[model samples]
Target chain A: MTIDDGPASDRVRLRRGANNGVYERQAVLDVLDAGLIAHVGVATDDGPIVIPMAYGRSDDSLYLHGSVANAALRAADGTDVCVTVTVIDGLIIGRSPFHNSMQYRSVVVRGRARRLQDDAERVDALRRVSNHVVATWDQARPPTADELRRTMVIAVPLLEMSAKVRTGGPVDEPEDLDGRHWGGSVPITSTFGDAVPSPDLRPGVGVPSSVAALDGTAVHGLTTRP
Target chain B: MTIDDGPASDRVRLRRGANNGVYERQAVLDVLDAGLIAHVGVATDDGPIVIPMAYGRSDDSLYLHGSVANAALRAADGTDVCVTVTVIDGLIIGRSPFHNSMQYRSVVVRGRARRLQDDAERVDALRRVSNHVVATWDQARPPTADELRRTMVIAVPLLEMSAKVRTGGPVDEPEDLDGRHWGGSVPITSTFGDAVPSPDLRPGVGVPSSVAALDGTAVHGLTTRP
Candidate 1:
């Protein structure tokens, strides 16, 4: 998890909190696994566009999908894309206002994302992304051939990815040591509430065991649950 | 709040949920107020770069600040920037995985952001931004002249902005009705928790009432709180 062992390129370097940062393969995978949506940044002809897209991780590869006609997805194919997933744990309110920061675990992956041309590979990627949001989604109902044809999936190998993280309290300047401002942290925790059945649900269809079994936290949080 | 009443540009038009979507002045303001970060999309020599930055709203304008020497600030001055703020409220899980979508509220403002040349305006914008994050922050410690000199603030009038929102349950296709699959939603709510006191707080200095009384939730939900 040391900074020295992070991505070799300068772009993925950790500028802040170098001491407490984690850039190891396992650490980056953990952060990605915990996140559901990824803020995807793509360089477009007009400018850089950041779109919130659902993503999935399989081994060391990251998969993303959008409509087949989506320009961002088309442009991202065979090009370098900066995919960032940020989980804000809390607001680190320091003694001094200047020291205030966010306690977040973020992974910035910079790599060339190529379109998945193989049908089997694309279907597998789509299934992985579907299960990323819901564990039982893959087994629920498979997408028809027409549906698969209309969807575009891209894969980015995580060879050059890096995870930069910051935790703990604010590091205020020496002069602000005795400041009277009340500051510490406002912790943030993301959880899933009980599934609310659709109002138009069909009769006699009981809730799936997978959906009913879900607790009030993220699906990935199940492993961490006591 | 109809699409016709919004910006004349085709890109700002609502393609989905046109009937239920909102584009009114207050709706746009509400979306801005509910968010703390904005993705500033700027054009670079190579391609477009989108960076996440803290933002503040005042009247009909949005303000963003950065170091004077930062390339983003320099490139953004007097240039058309696409400032977007999005908050995902929930995961709209549907019976068919293809219908799974995110319940989100997002506002996009497209205009040329002008740098504040006047010192007074810069200071005022800074105050507005600081107050947006923490209501009592501006009055707590006014920026010194040196601090002001080191920072650059840009203001973009919210004139040609559009608010796009998607709420309620999933809009599943009718054909998937009888499919024996679970369908519902995973709700998400963000809130401020009990403030923790700084470890180095001076004895006898209590938390200010302004900070203590703060209930950091979507302003629209203020009256809807349980």
Candidate 2:
């Protein structure tokens, strides 16, 4: 297995397939763009806690939001945190039990997450995070002073980020060739469905083109290409 | 918010979103079935390690396998472990930053994992794990004694488990509704594509009907109508 060296800004040198794995930069960004919820792993005084939070990416910086009083945000500030975003493509069914694996794209970012203090920077971070989920959403409505005051946002510079990917058929051992097991691969795909208008919406509210255009296409345009 | 008075097994509780969550048994099982890889969270002497592992479920028991020499397997045995499986459904776009949330289906299982000792039981557990990705695989081939010896499988009884799910549009605070922000939901759905035969397969190898029949359906049939 070939291991690619990480960028200079990387702090925690990923061990490639060992401790830290980064197959390619584009693959990692693709998985990050396609995902909305990230499992933020933070080491606390008690133990490690994996908290699911909404995150947004701007180039290499990843921003996350939580309650102002949340324990995860406090523990993660100025400390090395592991933020993982995984997108499962399919299931690999090998002829033998030992050969089965999952086709997935995952990005592991290890860095010190600093709490955003400046009002303007915090607002910009919130907008970036919002736009990640739905483009042009930040311009739709900006946060009020009070709303921003109640929310806490943290920024983790993707310095030592690495993306690891596994695709294609199961790599079964040669000794198991004649086992006659029904082994193969199952390709998983995710897409967006027709937009369901909210029940409380006023009658005759037309769906926005951005939301309507998602039908029949991958939600985030993130999938393994042949 | 109504705290579900249902039995402990039926109550779906999440510390994050206590309100607007479902605890139905079928719903929980569907989420578990649809997932391919599960992040096994185990508390080790050093700290907490979340390892990705392939899993098989039989009735109320979830099975996990690892190398016999792996420290994860050793720490998981005879200890309380938390196994979390989360499937992202969509991105909720709220008018304000505080209201943003991800539509997801996640199950948090807390219980003790016991190592499988009996050869017969171990063989059966391996078979179930195999059939998890590919149905009808258990009867296709039997594992050799040596193969079973190299693998260590642990079964975690789902005695204390809970499933948390979030769907639909963003729950914006009343004041932010008319705040000029475009608020809606970006729905996500996962489907299985047509099966692709392995490149190394022998010529004229017919595609199994079980694999071929999964087109356009959720891989594990995890969708349930409530």
Candidate 3:
């Protein structure tokens, strides 16, 4: 396997199955936008740790916030970190177990993380993060100044990134394509159930459009549109 | 946030919302068994990198594959690595943006990785990895000696691991629970579609049992049971 360049970037090191490398910026963005959580890798004195963190995407940045895992980000500030998000599509079952694979879309973003200290940017990023998960900014109470301080928001530019996608039927070895074994892809699907309302909801409160309009692709980013 | 002991080891570094920590070994094992892919973190000369790879869970070990991404794993051989797998349940919506989060179950296993060299173990691990994704070993053509030799497999002990879980309704601030904002959990659903037969599938080969049974929760592991 040799290194194949993607998007003329220094960070992308795709090899082996270079055909799976996706170079389109829009394609990479689509995966990032649809993904719910990103696995963040940051190095520390203890060793390298990869953490699953919920992220919000802007046009050029990814806001990662999961207050509980803030320690990893805190250490990642000004240091290179790898953020990977993947959407599994299905299982690729070939004529042989050796040829079986998975259909997935993955994006790896690498860059130095910057901690957000400014209140306005922090609030905006937080709002995007909130809406990214399930839009609740408009009706929900806004974050107080104290809450903002308590929360930690880290931003990573989406400039250095790469995308890989696997689709279609399995690629079987010539000798094994005898048609005796069953081969095809079994699609993995996620069906959203009805919303479970809070026990002490206000009398007139109804499900928000964001909660109502989850099409399984992802939560619509329109509600928080500027 | 403070460090709490989970199953007695020097690893678990959980902080902030310590109640989220689930210290039981069985709970950790359950997450590993259910997950299909894991984001593996390995420290390389380039820096810390996280690669999402398909993994199969054996009692005390995990076999990581995704042959294309084997480069990262090869560099991690005999080195400390962190493996993190996550299963997202729903979006935890609070009355305020600051309190919003996602309901998830995640396990973090940390330890050195050893590349499997023995053919017997390699074939065994590969079969487990295949079954873990979708059971297809029974009817599918078996891997040849050459194919097995061409493949790469690595194993990591399930030691120094931690599990974190977030469930239930949002933890709303007393002041903001006025029922003004609609808040609850929107479950994320995955539904598997019918098997898409390969373009050149053998006419009489019916779908395998593994392909027939996909419950969204996961592909059942009974077929691969010894």
The top-ranked prediction according to TM-score is 3
In the predicted model 3, the residue pairs found to clash are A189-B190, A189-B191, A190-B189, A190-B190, A190-B191, A191-B189, A191-B190, A202-B179, B1-B16
Better of 1 and 2 by lDDT: 1
Worst 10 residues of 2 chain A by lDDT: A11-20
Q: What is the lDDT of residue B214 in candidate 3?
A: 64
TM-score of chain B of 2: 0.86
Q: Would you estimate the TM-scores of all the predictions?
A: 0.87, 0.83, 0.92
RMSD of 3: 3.4
Best by DockQ: 3
- Cα lDDT tens digits for candidate 2, B106-166: 7766677899999888877777776665564543445567778988999988656666677
Clashing pairs in 1: A48-B48
Clash count per candidate: 1, 1, 9
* lDDT per residue (tens digit) for residues A126-184 in model 1: 87887775665654666778878889999988877677577666766566667666566
Candidate 1's displacement at residue A164, Å, is 3.1
DockQ (C-alpha based) per candidate is 0.46, 0.36, 0.70
True contacts kept of each: 0.45, 0.33, 0.84
Instruction: Arrange candidates, best DockQ first.
Output: 3, 1, 2
Per-residue CA lDDT of model 2 for A1-226, tens digit only, reads: 2356654443333442343355456656777887656777666554455666778877768999877877768888988777777777777766665666677767767677899999988888887777675554534456678788878889988666666667788766675555444556777887777766555444555566666766778754643221
